[model samples]
Target: MGQHESNTKLIWQVFGFLSIVTIVEVILGIIKPHGLHFTNFLGTSLLNWIFIILTLVKAAGIMWYFMHMNHERKNFVNSIILPLIILIPYLVTLLLIEGHYIHEVMGSYINWKY
Candidate 1:
């Protein structure tokens, strides 16, 4: 019974943390401060980068807590995280390259037509 109660409290804590993070994301998206929106980093706006980073934080938190990754062995955690370290960058690079090519080719037409 004590263990169950402790687990329930932890679950609520995780829930509260996730809720707060999401609320922050929503508020930032709505507010879109000029400084963050206008500044560019790596071809994307700072605001967009913030959204991406916050989203990644939320994902890691979910995986660590809700999926019980925290209870897993160190080797198991490394096994999952290490591959993503390589793959996520590779995939993002692909997206950026393809998106840039497509934008160069089709952006004018799409904007004018629309």
Candidate 2:
């Protein structure tokens, strides 16, 4: 009972932090500054880079604190995270390639003529 209550309080703290991060992300999205409009590594825009880093930070914090991954055993933690690590890059690559294909198709083949 005591331990449960302690964990409940910790969960609330994590939720609060998550909420704050989400709010900041929304604000940044709404108030996008010109300074962050430049392209950086791999041609990813600076604004997109900011969003990606912040999103990853929020994800890691949630998984570590809210999901209690930090308290799990070594094998348990690796089993979940290692698969995600392997899959995310592949997913991103597929998305990027498909996006570029869509862009080229729309730009070249989809001529608006009536």
TM-score of each: 0.83, 0.73
> Which structure among the candidates has the greatest lDDT?
1
5 Cα displacement, candidate 2 (Å)? 4.6
Root-mean-square deviation of every model: 2.7, 4.2
What would the per-residue lDDT of candidate 2 be over residues 1-114, giving only the tens digit for each residue? Answer: 665445777778888988998998898788877677545554455777677778878988988886889989999999998998888767766776786678678977677331
The collision pairs in model 2 are none
Error of 1 at 59 (Å): 0.8
lDDT (CA) for every model shown? 0.84, 0.77
Q: Name the best candidate (by TM-score).
A: 1
